[model samples]
Target: MRNFKKYWSFVLLFFSAFSVFSQDVQFTQFYANPLYLSPSFTGGIVGYRVAANYRNQWTFVPGTFNTFSVSWDHNSPAFRSGFGVMAMRDQAGDGNLANTRMGVLYSYDIEPFPDWHLRPGLAFFLQQISIDFSKLIFSDQLTSTPMPPTSVTQPGKDAVWDIDVSSSILAYSDNMWLGVTWDHMLKPVATFYDDNSRLPHKITVHGGYRYITKGFLLSRIEESFTVAFNYRVQDIYRQLDLGLYFYSQPISFGVWWRGLPKNSVGRRVDALAFMVGYKWEQVSMGYSYDFTISRLGLASGGSHEISMIYEFRLTPKKRWKAIPCPTF
Candidate 1:
């Protein structure tokens, strides 16, 4: 009876929420890659910047499940505004399901105080989702007991259209910054298989502060540190993350901890994240690893991510204020 109940629960969850329609890409280090989450983060750095990131997840499980993204952001110093373009592709489960998204963003900055400025931004997005019904394998018991021939064939590829809006308020000095953003203003249906079932939109709020301490331990070495956190809430899940970063001139390092909701097995799972990176001139390269601590750990080897970013000063003729190095 206990086994039957567990199986029933799994079936209900799978049909209701565990399917591909509700699955979203998970990021262990969102602060290091802000553009992946919010379009308002475009041009939050300085000058013209280009970034690329690749993520490999659930290595412990078989088959390929990975995601890749690329984005470019540029700010006009003369106009004090910015624009960006981004694209992403995700594939999972033997290519039975895939998702692709493209976005364009524009932002305008307002100077409220002598040293502080607020930026309001907007982004328009296009999303495409595809599912392969032919590749899906149903349980033998259900397939063998089919009542009608027409019921054997399932719905084929589903293409969906959706829109999202976001805004952010940023305040900064020479060395520190604080910002907040709300994403996915317009929730859209992802599952064309059933009109009654829809994926819930997600909301995230985050902020960070950085401090540069000179001559901390010795004259030659300087320490730069940052503390950051974010809270994300959705219909069925909520996550909280806290992280700290430390860096010297050439090499940077950081660690983070993420808390997850209790699972059906009554286990509280968490993840340990570590990052390392190097910066040279106007280019930076970084990588991060996440180790899961839960019953699913045996099935998921871990997760790996790599990112690269480049920034170029667009206004060569005008003398501009120095912009701090971007952490995201």
Candidate 2:
């Protein structure tokens, strides 16, 4: 048992050191949200939209992390294309990182029948990642006995460039829709160590279906049910998440279960997420909390997420009926 503890401790130290150079950010509960990480999700809505999100993780753990992001997306009716931009900043312990991305999406609509429309889109993205290494605290064990205390002065900073190409196919009717998207095609590296120790890229595939059932036992209370699932695969690990959402016109609630990766040796971990949101006119607010089912449950408190979204429609006035919208 002593040897086992030492082995695991070494493993954690190695991963923690490597994490200083990795560009990939970790999230606790992913299925409750989608647009937080993927730039290709731009122009998915009907009109011009803006979204902002903030997350606080592991409240029980000392020196936990916080992440904040803001994004704007707009689609052109005349050009049948869309554009979006997003920026994010993450801070954990003493290390701070920032990312900015710009995306352009071109979509083509296919009319397979009278009532159904299929839209396939291709998007190009450019991202810049910057790291501030001065804040990081290296392990004291790395130093010799009677070593002097370390100071934050004379820290290192590094930056990297990454490009991503993604594609999505969306099938929609009046009440039902399905979509599939692929991200992180370039597999850009952002390690502080040797260039060969590259971070692995991830691929995710997801789809969801919604069903509306009206008036069984309660009057004026209608139920909208949805089932969503996603699979994420990478070189180090993979995860599968499935959940159900029950919603009315003004409020929504959801519960999810996440399956552990096959190679994970730790106690199986699951998440119970509860989400509530309200829609008012063209604006919406959402909040979710997740509780873990692993041994760390006592040590790592919980995760919290909050988001705000707004949408605006741009349409031609009656007097502009004769004028055609400009194309880009």
Candidate 3:
């Protein structure tokens, strides 16, 4: 049994290495992490906005994936510009492999026609990846009961740093919006060893529409239904999220389907996510859960995510056009 457990540990470590460097952390609640989604959303608001998000994936696993992000952004109505700062951290596996990112972004808004606007954005990030070599178990060490140090050469560096860049453009009106983002334009080198391994570029295209309905009893009260989709591709991996949302005052509900229904590469359905949110005054908070449906099944223990947003204005407030997108 001990030998069997050690073998699985080696298997887990091998897979974790690939996942850490090959894939980017994804949040089920895309809008909740606007700055992370697209730099064009940097200042997509009239006033100051702050957001925080957390996600835990595959809880049943020993070394689960945990990610966290925080961002702040605000728009300048006079200059028709937006600026923001963001940071994120993602960690996985018992080896304590981690990635940290910090960045600043800018966006400028242009009006092409009446009630329609376009935003172009750019961001620069500093990325760092680290791992604890001491925690790793080698194949030679597993051959004996009292594991002896194997003749393995260390990478010489505990962490690696790189500069990354991303750009995006958004076009929107009062009730509809569309955006596209190109990430990792720099193809930053991501390796702890002497060899060069570049992080692949990712492309994301997202859009949404909202339909507003008036309340029967109160004419002033408005309820809205939104349909949104986010499609992303990185390397050979493709992920699509289709979601429906309903918002009535302080309450919001959402349901999302991830992955493709019919694909030539076998069963593509990954998970179904459900979300609930609440807003009071200037603060909005949300929680979501992903139900794993793939071959991993329920044993993966699913994923959980939480997000919060606060919007506020400074003195001498000025009216600015709001981007028509889902708030959660």
- How many clashing pairs does model 1 include? 1
- How many pairs of residues collide in each model? 1, 0, 0
Winner by lDDT between candidate 3 and candidate 1: 3
The prediction achieving the highest lDDT against the true structure is 3
Off by over 4 Å in 2: 1-14, 17-40, 97-106, 141-156, 214-223, 261-268, 314-328
The lDDT for every candidate, in the order shown, is: 0.66, 0.58, 0.87
Q: What value does the lDDT take at residue 50 in candidate 2?
A: 83
Q: What is the C-alpha lDDT profile of model 3 across 1-328, one tens digit per residue? A: 5566656655655566766878799899989999999999998876899999999999998889999999999988778899999999999887789999999999999999988899999999999999998987766677787888754566789898999999999999878999999999998877776766788999999999988885532222357889999998888778899999998887899999998635424368999999999987779899999999999989999999999999995543544567877755
| Candidate 3 clash figure, as a count | 0
Looking at candidate 3, what is the lDDT of residue 145?
79
223 in model 2: Cα distance from truth in Å? 4.5
Superposed by TM-score, candidate 2 places the C-alpha of residue 299 at a distance from the truth, in angstroms, of 1.6
Weakest ten-residue segment in model 3 by summed lDDT:
214-223
Q: Tens digit of lDDT per residue, candidate 2, span 128-150?
A: 66656555444443456765444
TM-score of 3: 0.92
Candidate 3: regions farther than 4 A off = 1-15, 215-221, 261-266, 314-319
